[model samples]
Each structure stands twice: as structure tokens, then as C-alpha cells.
Target: LTPELKCDRPDLRGNLVIKEKAITYQAGKEAVTQLQFERAVSCFSKAITLQPDQLQTQFYVERAEVYLQLCDFNSAALDYKHACYLEPQTKTHFHRLAFIYYLQGQCLCDQGMFLDALESFAKATELKPNFKPYHMRLACLTALGRYSDCIRLVTNWLKIDPPSADLFTLRARLYHQINQAALCYYDLKAALRLNPSCADALSLLEEMKEAAECSRQQAVSKAVEGELTNALSKITTAVEKNPEKAQYYLFGIIYRRLKDFIAAIEDLVLAVELCDAVAECSEREKPDNSNSLEEDAQAQLVLTYNDFAVHCFSQGFYSEAIKLLTKAIHEQRDESGLFINRGCFLKQEEWLFALADYQQAEELDPQNRSIWFRLALIHNTMGLHSFGKNFQDAADKFSLAIKYKPGVAQYYGNRAKAHTRMHRMEEAKLDALSALILGSTNDELLRLFPGCSLSDVISSATAQTVKAQLMEQTQMWKLAGRPVTEAVRKVLHQRQSLYRTGPRLSPLRLADASEAALCAAKHPYAWRNFRGLGLNC
Candidate 1:
């Protein structure tokens, strides 16, 4: 019969002489079995109308199933909800209702109606509390960035079911999204423990390790090139990819190098916390296998302490810098660089302590040029502060510097100055000549003796050659009032004329009196000539 005719004859009797609704319900089930969803829906609707007060819960459930097949989600949901109300105590009824809501949620999710889909899936989970509905709800929550909700839901579900690898992996990924990296790693490790062959968990772990290594290499390269901003960017990406101890340690180091002390401290502290967490997690593992992570973390912690001390020193916080360095030294006594760096800071305020640190560094690394150089510089500076009384000390330090780095001209020049201050004229002259031979400037020689002529200080042959070069280059007789020295004039000439390329030399490079006096007595009009030429000197 046609659907219209069947609807018009709804009052017809059944085989038991009961209401026509039972016969119509049977026909709807037959239509559903045949996959004629529209015909089944129409027949179920007519049966429900014919026996509105006496309708069985099966009528609504059957129609809901047909509506689901037809992809009419709203109708299916309404019928399933009604079936739930009619058979509230039946497990089968609620399970069927949950299935319909789950299907509706899937359709909504496909349509990009995430909030609606989330509601549907949540209701399904609430009704059934099954794995499929719970998983679907978590997917919806995750897609919506509802991390806290997803975590709570998964955590509650875990209480009901024994731990599964896939479920743990899902929760771990959710924790990762929320930046709870330690917790994420904890869950991932747990997942691995449950099922060692879980490919997805293993792949994620490997990716994090690779990303951390790549970031560390890139950061180091950029920092070495003095590209601090790019280095920070690389380390930041690394931290995002893997919020592990090594990555945080490297990030802290980069921040310290960039002189961002506050950020460096925060990252370093976090790194230590993560290290502790990792240690706690791994405590149960085999003792004979060794923990490389723990060793690396401890090393990084010491390095971070040393680097932070350097940062403090750069900002002139000497006491704090020394304290931090002391802590680092206490932790790792074999680090020679730390001793040298701490000595540098202590040298400013505590000479004795500085000496002790330098001596320690020397013992640790006898052949290190930098340690020797720093020791010599500190001694030289201290001696200079005592006027001529400390000339022997200054000279001794300069000698040590020369012994370690024999080719350095500055060391010879510094020693010559110390010898001059002590009135050891012959020794001073010899050292001065050695400095000159080693490429020390004539200006340094002139500074050592103010009133003496270049010939009085050195051989006339050397004096005359330097004098001739000065006269040709500077015309130094220009300044009428100054005492003239040929070597000084040569230095002045280079500064005032030769080194100046264009219209004028920078004010900073202007020739001073000692340099300008080499030929000042021989060419008195040179100053006027210079003025007429628009030269500032």
C-alpha cells in the first residue's frame, strides 16, 4: 500500500484485534531491514501517531536508527532522546541512544561544527562511558584546544579501565600541547613501558631528540658568530620541540651569552627541575647501565653556573659573580676556565684571592697562554697603581708574560716602562730598543722620556732616520712652542697627515704635543701652513 493510504487507515485492526500501531511497527522493522530508510521512517511515524499514549520505546529507537541511516542527525537525536526517557533503566536503550549521539557528533565534526560536535560526543560519553565515545570526545576537546577538559576526561576514564598504551599516548600528546613537558614525557615513558613496540610513541620521542640536537648545534653556531638574536630564535624553537633538560640547559646558556641574565636564570632553574624529574623517573632502571642523561645534566648545571657568573661580572656585580663562580668551582673543581674567570673578577677587589685563583688555574693548566696572560695583566695593573715602588713586581710580571708569549710586543713595551720608572736607564734603553724592534710604536718610546732628544735615548743613526721620515711626512716645526723629537715627530706626522685620508682627521686622532715636536724648531711656519690648509691640528 502507498504511504498516504497506510496513514489514512491508521485505525485498522491487527491480527490480535489490537491497535493498528503494532502492525505498522512490524512493517517499519521490515522496511529498515530492506535498507528503505525513508519508508521505514514514515511507517514508524504513523505507528507512533496511531498509539501516541501506548507506543513502545522500540518505536522511537527504530525510527532513530532509520533517521541515522538517512543522515538526518537532528531527527535521529530527538527520537533517541525520547527512547532514552521511555526506557531509562535499560542498558540496551541507553547504549543505542549513545550510539545515535555519537553518529550525530561525527556528522557535526565533519561539518566543522566543533562546539556542537563536542556537546554530542560529551553526551554520548556521559550515557555510555565506553572507550569509543570517550576517545571521540577527547578528539573533539583536543581540536578545540580544551586541553584541561581533555586531560580531566582521560584521567577519569583511566580510573575505570586498566591502562592502555594508546590511551596513555593520547594523554601524553595532550600534556605536550599544554607545555607540561615533564608530565608528557612521564606519560610517554609509561606508554612505552606498557607496549614497547608502540611506533607512534617511539617516533615522537625520536623527533624530540633530533630537534633538540639540531637546535643546540644551530644555537652554538650563531652564538659563535655573535648573532645573538638568531641564536635565541634557534634555542626557542628547540625548547618548543622538546622541553627536556638538555634543551633548557642549552637555552639558558644562550641567554647568558646574550647577557639576558633574568631569562637565563629562569631557564637554568627549569632545566635543573626537569633534570631532577628525569632522575626520579629513571631511579628504578638498572644501576649497571648508567644514566648518560644525569651525567650530561650535571655537567650542564656546572657550566651554567660558570656562565651566569660571567654574566654577573659583565654587569659589574663582582661579589655576586664571585659567589656564583665559587659555587661552580665547588661543584666542578677541574674546570680551569672557571678559575681564570673568577680570578678576573676577584682581581678587581681582592688581589690575594685573585692570586690564589690564578695559581689554581696555573696548576690545572700549566701551558695555557690565556691564564698566564691574565695573571701578568693583573700584576702589571696592580704594580702601576703603586707608582714606582712596585716597578720590580711589574717588571717580573711582564717578563713572565714575555716568557709565555715571547712574540708579543706589548709585553716588552710594558716591561721597558717599568724599568724606566726605576731609573735603570741602560736596562730601560735596551728593553725599549727591543720593544721597538718588536713593532712597538715610537710614540711609546717618546712617552718614556719627555725632555730627552731621540738621539740621547737611541743611536744617532736610528734617530736621524726617524727624524728625516718625520720632517718629510709631518712638517712638525708647525707648532712653535713645543720641544721637538724626531721619533715623536714621525709618530705625529703619521697621525696628523698620513693616517688621515680625506678632508680632515677625526678629533680623536689629532696629534698631541709630544708627537708634534720632532721638527717644530726647524719649520716654524708649518703651523700657519697647516691652518691655511684647513687642518684642525
Candidate 2:
């Protein structure tokens, strides 16, 4: 039929009957209510074809939802856009347009096309003027270090919703971007007033306040910028003037940075004790806790505790770090990095209990290669070579570690050990050679295998030279281009036959070789050990 004629046709019958098909489209809607998306799409498509212009937008929209269920995002977007053009007055159409753009943006973001995702998210926010996607784009811009654009967009969003806690928090983040510590603290205080339970707002407020105080103190006390003794003298003088203040922890941090571990621990302990007494006295004064103010104090204490733990770990104080990290982990179990840090400290102490912690870390985040390598190393150290086999299980991980960290000669050396144990001699030799070549000192290879000297194993020659050396070694025992001893000859013959043909044994009969060797000591006629065989133990 001609295109024009088909458009004008009104004589179709049976399933194509307009009234019945309209009923079928209505039944499709009922089917959707019954959760039959496939049948709904089928009926909707047939209805649209039958009653040309009757419910094109509605039918396409329904079908588009079905396509979305089938994970056909591109087709769903196409159908949705068509529906929008068909019925521009539908608010749902514009919402779906924005939703599709959001989906596309997320897909692009997952693919690491952040700029493309930013454009798509901008389109979505233009369509809906919503906070969710706009904030997402703002965060993405911030992460990409596009601070100017992030500042402008976030400022505009804050103006549109001046009192919103999220906007205030975001504005505080913007102030942080420009290093305006006091301004960031003020915005964060505003955010906490709006939503006292927001952990991020409380954290930002505490951090900005600390930064501002640090700046003020640094500017006043040129005496603070000195050795630990000088700083401690200054703090002592300041405390003599005002002993009840909370600035002792700041002095503790200075001592900690100066490597005065004993003094730092003493001062930090005193600061925590003072802070506790203040908190207790305040609680006695105000029996009813103010939520926002209490949250602010709690945030400060958490930061102080976390920093103390990290400082202890850095100073090889694993037990102290573990004590603090355990408390933190009890409060926040979802933080996988804490487990990783604890595992590292445990490893430094050679505590096998760290294995369980590392396993937990890997469960939470499987992509951390350091955790994987540590696990593998722990297994190898414990003589659990089978469990350590993952390092050699896939060529990709072995290759990736080699590529990024060619300097860790011990890693290559250990991989060589693994490959050698697996009977991959050529790969083992290649790894050993790479280690010897890249390692700053040849002592690393010698340190690796205290059992065997790597220099003796790896000749001062290239790979081709080593191959030639092996060939020379092989030739030393050759008798008429083959092994000299009868047993060794038979073994080699069997190996060659198995390689050249199929699995067949007994290419040569060894009926008299043993007795011949026994008689050779007395008769002077039977075969003896080959010259290079070194038969005497």
C-alpha cells in the first residue's frame, strides 16, 4: 500500500478493528496494573499501529517503561523523547526526560567520562531544577578541581535555597575551597543549626575551627615555631597564665610533630583528661543536652582521638593505635580503611591475627592490591604456599604489579620463586633477571634466597647467554648426541617418544644394566657412571 493510502486507511478488520484495538490498549493498561509488562508493551504497540494517532504518546511511554525494565536505556530514551514531543504539556514527560538524562549521566560517570556526565547532569538540572543532580554535578566539578565553576554553581544553588542545610554545608565546602577557614566555620555552624545530626557538617565545622585557631596561634607565638623544648616552654608559660584552657592538645600536637614521643603522649593524655573534666562539669550544669552543641563536641573528640591513633601508628606505637582504632571501628563498622590500617600495624608487629582483618578489608574492597599482596605475602611467610598461589594464578595481576612497581625487586624475586616452584623455569629465570637488573644493589637477590646464591644461578650474562650456558651444560653429559647412562638414556628415549608420538612407554629394554653395573666393579667390562654425573655422594 502507498504511504498516504495507508495513513488514510479505515477498512481494516479482525484484530485491526479500531474499537476492539482501543479496548485492547485499555486491557494493556490493566495488564500493567497486573505487572505484565511484556504483554502490555505488545498490546500497546498493536493498539498504536491499529488506531494510528489515538494513544501514540501513552502507548510509547508504556512501551518505553517496558524497554527500561529490559535494560534498554537507549531505546527507552528514544521512546520517552518521542512521547515528550508528542505531548509537550505532560509534566511526567519532562520528568522522564530528566530521569533519562540522569541515568545517562550515571552511566557515563561509571565509564569515567566525567565531563560528559557533567554535561548530561547540567541538562537534567535545567529540565527539573532539582537539588540532587545539581549537587552531584557540583561535587564532580569539585573532584575534577574545577573550583571556580563549582563555586559559582554552588553559590547560585545556595541563593535559591538559602536556609537549606545541604546548601549551607556545600557553601562551607566552597569556603574551604578558597581556604577561607573562618568563613567555612561560620557556614558549617549554620549548617549544623539546620541539621544537627549531619556528621559531615559537624566534621567540617570542627576542622575549620581548628584551622582558624591554628592560624591565629601561629601568628601570635613565633616561639611556637621552634624545637620541642621551646614550644613546651611557651605552652607552659601560656598555661601558667590560663591553665584551665583547652589549648594543651595544640601543644601536644607540636610535641608529637617534633618526635618527642614520651612528652607528646603525656601532654595528649593530660589534654584528654582536661577535656573530660570540662565535659563532665558542663553536663552537670546542663542536665539536658543541647543536640547541636553536643554533636560539635563529639566531632572534636572523634577528630582528636583519630589523630592520636594515626600519630601513634606513625611512631611505631601499634598497640596504642590498635586500642584507639578498635574503639573507632566499634563506632563505625563500615569503614574498611580502618581495618586496612589496623592490618598494617598488626603486620608490623608480625601478628598473624592481622590476617583476619586483611580478609575483612578485602571483602569490603576487593580492588586494593596492597591488601591482596599482603595477604599473599603472609600466606607465603607462614609456609602456606598453596594459599599464596593467587599471585601466580592469573598473568594479569602478576603483569600489572610488575608494570607499576618495577622497583620492588623483592617482589619480582619472590614471583620468580613462585614460578620456579610451579616448574615454570623460563618464566622464573626472566623474573630473576628483571629483579637483578632493576634492583639498585645486587644484594637484594642474594638476600632473597639465602639458600642458593642468585649470582651462581643467574650468570653475569643476558637471557640468550644463559640459554647458551644451559645448552653447554646439557652437552657435557651427551654420549653420541644422547645421555650416557643406560637408565638416563632410557628415560630420555621415553620422554622423546612421548613428545614426538603419543603416550607410549618402554622404548628400550633395560634387562642387564643393573647387573652389568654390579659386575663392572669386578669385571672391568660393564658400563659405569658418566664422567660429569658425579656418582659418589
Candidate 3:
């Protein structure tokens, strides 16, 4: 129990343990013969701990072979290094050690841990200065973007080994990454001499053949500088070099800028087809919305179709414009803007189709106020055509529109017409009055009261003037005090909601001395400068 102290002198060794060490060594040799690697390693380790051979390398070599059987590479490598040290003439032991390091480097590289892989590879290269380890280390350096290190490694490799076509070509690429074009060219040329049919070298040579570059990137720069013709020329050469999906898309963009709609449409359509084909082959992974090539191409196509359709509409080709928009709608059904635009064209003579389009648009974007307003317009127009049969639907749609965007005077004006058609006089008067006060140029109201200006309506003498004017036109319709005053109060309340003590504040004050028919009012053109609402027909 003295903790088994080791004797520094060989003569001081205990006799019983010295024989046991020999026995352990013999047992290890027997375990190896029987292929029991774990037991062999255990026995050999104990033998070495008891009586390690310093002069003779047999002890390390035997344990190293057992470690190899167990695939314990690190331990096997350490044992072989000791063997190499004891017998400096045995080159195989050094090779075995380097091979173990190489295997470790390969394993780390496969796991994408490039930095660790580089360390292992560097150790392998230092042990055995050969092309294989050098090349492996170069790969790790390249992966880590240590291009300068890779160049130095390759340079060292070139000095040691005979000329290799692959090595030269690879070094050329490393030079290229660091933007050393002259050095890259020299390496590529050297590679060509070793093997004239080297494909990679030949390809790189062809890319550098174009003067000032035929890359699509160059074309993009030209396009940005507003040189469409020159940009088109560059992109044409790029397309010839590589007719990829992105190339066709760039071609489409250039054509669009040139206002050559026919060619633009063709190229974009091809881009969509090519992108879809690639997606299909790759099992159609969900694309990121912002950067998806297919989405961008299709979106551009929709816009082009919209502009072309509008142009056709202006040229009085209504049917052709409708067909174009119909194609656009088919292309991008989720686009609520497309449906609303198409409905505007159909509103001319094809009322039912317009109604269907607006309904579909509503389903796609239920919260969009433009869709709501378009629906209201279609319904009101239909009610007018059918003699007030759809006035109630028209009123409801306008209310929905107003609920989302409460300050649009056009919405209230149209709703007032619907309410008047439905014989709801109270609602009609409130809406009509609100519409005029909020700056609606209600054409029907204008036709009814031709002499009443916007200034006259908002001025202090508005009450008496409106009553006298309305009575002069239709003496039978009696003007009331309470409803007219309440309508004015509601308009002021709305004005307060929009502007706080600003130039937009309403000028009219409520003296509760009002008796005027709202139908006697005209378009409020004076306040039109406040805000303009975007309403599509």
C-alpha cells in the first residue's frame, strides 16, 4: 500500500512484478492473435505502464497495431510517434502517424468545422510534406476564405511536387478570388501546358475573353445610367453566354424600360416558365416572398398588362383591354388591385361582369377601402339602371366604405343618391348635406341649385338664402329648422375630427336658426383644396 512507486534504476525492480510485466506482454500478444482488440489494448497498456521499452521500438509498434484495430486513431497516432522516435530509420511509422492526422482532418472537414480541420491538416503536412496533405489543407483554407494562406500552401506544394494540371488550375482559382488577375492568368496558362484539355481552365478563359465584361452585372450598371440601348446590347451578349432564368428576367426588365411591351411580355413569360420548371424539379420548396424570382417576374407581368390594358382602353379598344386584364387576373388572382382595375373597364357596358369582379376583389381583400368604394359604385349604378331595385344594396355597400374611410365626401354623396332612390328622405338629407359640407362636387345637387355657390352656402346668410332659393324653385317642399341645424352640427363635428384649430376648420357657426333644403346646396369647390380622395370608377 505504498502506492506502487516506480524504481528509477533497473536493478531496483521488484522480481515478482518484473515477471508479471513479461506475462502481461505475452497476454497482450495472445489477445491480438485472438482478435480481442479491447483486451489486447488493455493488456498492452498495463505492460507499457509496468515495463515500457525505451531502446527497442517493438512495444510501441505492438500497442499501436491494437489501437488501429480499435479505431482509436489519436492513441494509435501517439504510439506510432513514439515508435518513430525510438527507431528514426522506420519511415512507415511516420507515414502511419501522418495518415491518422489526415483521417482526422477529413472527418472534421466533412462536419464543416474548417478551422479544426485546418489544424489537423497542417499537422499532417508538417509530418509528411506531400501533395495530398497540402491539397487538403488548401481546401480547408479556401472554405474558410483564407485565400492568401491557400496561395502560400499551393505555392509550397508546387515547389515540392512535379507539375500537375489540376493543381495549377486550382491555384489559378485561388488567385482569382483575391482579385489578382495577372497571377491567375499565369497559373491558368501553366495549367494549359500540363493538360491542354482542362475544362475548368478553358471555361474561365472564355469568361475573361469579353472586353469590359459581358456579365449581366455590367448590363445592370448600364441600365441604371439610363443607357437602355447600350444596356440591351450588353445583356444580349450575356444571354448568349448563359441563357439562364435570371438572364431572361433581366432581358425582360430592359425591354420594359425601352417601352417595347411585346418583347417584355415574351421574356417575362419565359422567365416564369423557366422558374416554375426549376421549382418543379426541386420539389417546389416554399419561396421567400421578398426575393423569389418567380414572384417578381409574375408581378411585373401583371403591371405591364395593366398599363397595356389602360392604353388599349384609351384607344377605344374596350373589348381588347378587358381581355388583357382578364389574362392579368388569371395570372395573379391574389392581387386585389387587378380585379378592381378590370372592373373599371367592364363598368362601361358590361355591368354584370364588373359586379362579379368587384365581388371577387372584395373576397380577396375584405378590408381594402378601394374595393368597398368600387362595390358601392357598381351597386348604385345597377340600382339606377333597374329603377331603384338595388338602392338598398348600394346604400349598405357605401356604409361599409364610409366605415373604413369616414372622410371621403364622394362616398357620402353616392350614398345620398341611393337613399333618395329608396325614399329614405331623412337619411338622404343628412348624407346629401354632409356630402356638400365635406366638399363633394355632387353633380345632381349642382344641377338642382345652379345659382348657389360654395361661398354662399358656407357664408352667414346661408340659412335664409338656401330657403328662399329652394322655395323659389319648389314652394311645396317645406324647409325645417331642427334637421338642417343638426346636419350642420354633424359636419362641424366631422371637421373637428379631421383638423384641430387649423385653416381646415369650418367657417359656419351654429345659431340654431336654420331652415333650408339640402337639395338647394351646390358643389363645395372652395374647400376642395383641403384633401383629395383617390376613388376609382
User: Which ranges in model 1 have alpha carbons more than 4 Å from their true place?
Assistant: 1-73, 108-116, 138-160, 171-187, 239-253, 261-322, 332-537
lDDT of 1 by residue, 1-537 (tens): 999889767555333334466788888989988998888989999888776553557788878878888988788878877876887777787777777778888888888888999898878878876646445867777789899999998888788889998988888888878877667777888899999999988887786768767987898898889888998888776776666544446466667666676677678667656656655665575343234544544565566676667656667777887888788788667667777778855436576688778779878766565666667666655555553667788788777656544545577677888888888876676666656655567686765656865556555465456445434422332232144655566555556565567754333333577655754533322111101111110
Ranking by TM-score: 1, 3, 2
Top of the candidates by lDDT: 3
lDDT of 2 by residue, 1-537 (tens): 798778666664544586787798898889788988788778877877875664588778887887777666777878888888888888898898788778877777788888988887888898889646544677568767887788688677767765778878877787777765555667777888889988999877666555445543643474445555665665654443234445445465555555554555565555556556666775556334333333333333333445566667667677887786676566445445556666655436454667677677667656555555555554444432332645455333444344333345555666676676677877776767766655435554454445656555465556446456434533442322232565677767667443557555555555688876775534332222111211110
Answer with 1 or 3, whichever has the higher lDDT: 3
Predict model 1's lDDT versus the native: 0.69
Can you give the TM-score per candidate against the true fold? Answer: 0.48, 0.34, 0.40
TM-score of 1: 0.48
Instruction: Evaluate residue 199 in candidate 2 and report its C-alpha lDDT on the 0 to 100 scale.
Output: 90
Off by over 4 Å in 2: 1-47, 130-135, 189-202, 212-537
